[model samples]
Target: MSIKVENLKHIYAPNTPFETIALDDINIEIKTGEFIGLIGHTGSGKSTFIQHLNGLLKSNYGKIFINDLDITDEKISLTDVRKKVGLVFQYPEYQLFEETIEKDIAFGPRNLGLVEDEITQRVKDAMQLVGLEYERSKDKSPFDISGGQKRRVAIAGVIAMKPEILILDEPTAGLDPKGRDDILRNIKEIHEKEKNTIILVSHSMEDVAKLADRLLVMNRGKVEFFDTPKEVFKHEERLKQIGLDVPKVLDLAKKLREQGFDISDDILTIDDIKLEILKNLKEK
Candidate 1:
């Protein structure tokens, strides 16, 4: 599904001493099937902006359109909107409460009033999408699994809802390197197979650089930039001014360039750097 935001503005504790603007005059569009990375320092309105996408938070002044339907309309049903926009929050594993993994993953489908057969199928598909074996893990207690497995189960719960637009906030937070890699791989596979629009809110520049088709940078209640990762990272000084850093691989590429390695400015990943270095060596 496509998304368009126009003149969006939101404030906290409005008309009070503690009042603060959380989102200010924000506007952007996300095309269908695009993988967008949402990045910003803490308290930069990233969270606030995403909440508006799913109607969790209402803007004081602005309009939000999902596929040409103005969701900001007062008469619109947020419940229906939520069905199309699934949000997987940070530390979602902590919210797991079902006795078994299958039940937890099936919860959303069941809530949608789907029949037993469809619910069963959705649960199975969701589990499989996240790399969980349906026959092996379905009956196990969610709490009994590893942390990374639990996270997958949590994500599976949202996936079972079959949302066209998926928003994941810090999905890989607090994981070991291996666990992080596993979760990221699952996300990539989901996007590739499902062809759904994905908004990944992450603090790791490397993660976004590897996966996102475009990066949406947020600042203090405003948009800083929206462009491809390679293009956005070009403004290293501007990013630094906002307390953000380019991926470390870019730093390595910069150092290689300093040493007359002729590395291209478009290199964004470790694999890209590796291939470039090998090619340069071969030329020498």
Candidate 2:
């Protein structure tokens, strides 16, 4: 589903001494099935902005349209909107409350009033999408699983709803390298197979560089840049001013270029840089 935000504004503690502008006239359009990477410093309104997408937060000013339907309209049902836009917050495992893994993942679909057979199918599909073996894990307690498994169960709960637009906020936060890789790979597979719109909010530049089709950079409640990763990373100085950095591989490529190596600025991954170095060695 496509999302369009126009002149969106949000405030905290409005009309009070502690009032703050959390989102300032933000405007952006996300096309259908696009993978967008949202990056910004802490408190830069990244969280606040995403909360508006699924109606968790209301804007003080402006309209938000989902697939051309005005979600900001009072006539629109937030519940219905949420069905189309699923949001998985950081450490979603903390929200798991069902006695068994199957029940936990089934919660959203069950609430949608789906039939028993359909709900069961959704639960099974969600677990498989996240790499969980349904028969073995369904009866297990959510709390009895490892941290990464718990995280997958939490994500599967949201996936069971079959949202067209999925927003994941720092999905890999606090996990070890292997755990993080596992979750990220699952997410990539989900996007590839489902072809749904995904907005990934991440702190790791490398992750976004590899996954996102476009990068949306926020700065102090405003858009600093929105472009392809290669284009956005071109402004290394500007990103640094906002306390952001290019992927380490890109940074290394830049250093190599300065030393008279024929490194392409388009290189965004370690594998890309490695291949380029090998190609150059072959040419020599």
**Most TM-score-accurate candidate:** 1
* Residue pairs in collision within model 1: none
After the best TM-score superposition of candidate 1, give how far the Cα of residue 33 lies from its true spot, in angstroms.
0.6
- Who wins the lDDT comparison? 1
Q: What is the lDDT, from 0 to 100, of the residue 39 in candidate 1?
A: 99
How well does candidate 1 score on lDDT at residue 177? Answer: 94
Q: Residues 180-214, candidate 2, lDDT per residue (tens digit)?
A: 99999999999998899999999999999999999
What candidate 1 gets wrong by more than 4 Å, as runs, is none
Model 2 lDDT at residue 269: 87
Query: What's the lDDT of the predicted structure labeled candidate 2?
Result: 0.95
- What TM-score, computed on C-alpha atoms, does each candidate reach? 0.99, 0.98
Model 2 / residue 274 / CA error / Å: 1.5
